[model samples]
Target: MSMSGEDDGPADSGLAPEGVTNDLVELLFFAYRDFVGDPDRMLAEYGFGRAHHRVLHFVYHYPGLTIAELLDILRITKQSLNRVLKDLIEQGHIVQKTGRSDRRQRLLYCSETGATLTAELTRVQVRRVARAIADPVADEPKGARDEHGFAAAQGFLMAMIEPEERAAVRSLMARRARSRR
Candidate 1:
């Protein structure tokens, strides 16, 4: 509704009205906390944390990922990543190989141990996501459903990203899509 107490219809500008997103903000925070809780406990047993889990997760899923690419995806400084990279490498959870084209470039891959841990964590997270997406939506419009039940969820997440960065993010994740086939 507008300030004058009139319905403004749908917000087509793709921007929510001022001061209206607190509920969504809180929902995201709580949802993320719960989503990571299971993995957090499992990681603790290995004396690792979110950083380690994230590094292992990406390396396992995107085999042959470059150090530069991982840094971009994690958005962390090289120094920070170096620390986690060193630990994972030392623990035998990850292996770093020189790029075939550029010896200076480091290509990361999860080792057998890392892959096992990543799979366990992924299974837990996937179950959580599946359950959330399976939430009853009988009252929702028939036009809203999708073949995989991920349309709305994926759209919402992609929309939350900075508009200009969406394309690059999609490009970075393209391998995952292709690998599924």
Candidate 2:
């Protein structure tokens, strides 16, 4: 059970006996904080918060997302989501339409202003991620690490999610992509 040996077991391989990797846990925490920080500040300027940002981001990306679908995606209580939804609707940042077949369903869509603001907020985040992925290649050849970095990052992020949820997430992404076209 030598910690310094190349043949270290799971207990000595930088993970706790419970199989938790402290370094990864901390990295995820820090990464999420910074990733959402940019949008949080931007949302504050509009008298909104992270909740509003999340709603706007999702609705903007997935127009026509139903209230139930949004609730599922955000995993927030109805009351909590209602407050944010009310503000966004009253402020004219979002529009909710009754579903054609399901009259009880409220489909969400971002207004022009909302889209503009969401884009601006998202641009900062996209830039931050782009820099992060490209940083590894700063001293390397142009194409040497770009694809590898992107694929690795994507794969790592996907792997972090629960196995059962991965297919649903991918399906949602694919549906959104198809709708964008």
Candidate 3:
């Protein structure tokens, strides 16, 4: 059957609503694929996968993050987390220590090697992002246009997030930044 909107009535069409461009949906998919491509290849060399990359990224950023906090942030089951955590710890990419205040709690941190790998992966992605943003079509010469473009891009991405989760997302980012200082 032809899926074209021209052949189907509005109610029968599977297209997005007015003002929503289907091109944006496809662009996001392709953008994300390329964005993760470099890291995915590197992780394979270590016999790891995306899960390992995520764990390393989070622990590297949020040093001393509790097992519970990681669990919550990842939204994964304890059992699922245990497998990846065990592999990371065994490979010396991560270390777990007992919390000073709560002896039963395990706090996560990246080892020196983990930090190096994470930084390398992040550098690759950051370079790609910098190039994209610095492109003439994406960003204008220093001025109000540049600032406005940044704001518009930021606003667009933020709006893509679920409304209820936006505050929590912002809080986590701010907290991580403050912790680094």
lDDT of 1 by residue, 74-123 (tens): 99999999998899999999998999999998889888988988999999
lDDT of 2 by residue, 83-151 (tens): 999999999999999999999998999999999999999898787676665542122224453432443
Clashing pairs in 3: none
Cα-based TM-score, every candidate:
0.67, 0.66, 0.66
lDDT minimum window of 10 residues, candidate 2: 15-24
Query: Could you give me the TM-score of model 1 versus the true structure?
Result: 0.67
Model 3, C-alpha of 117: deviation from truth (Å) = 1.0
Provide the RMSD of all predictions against the true structure, rounded to 1 decimal: 13.3, 14.1, 14.6
Model 1 misplacement above 4 A: 1-20, 136-181
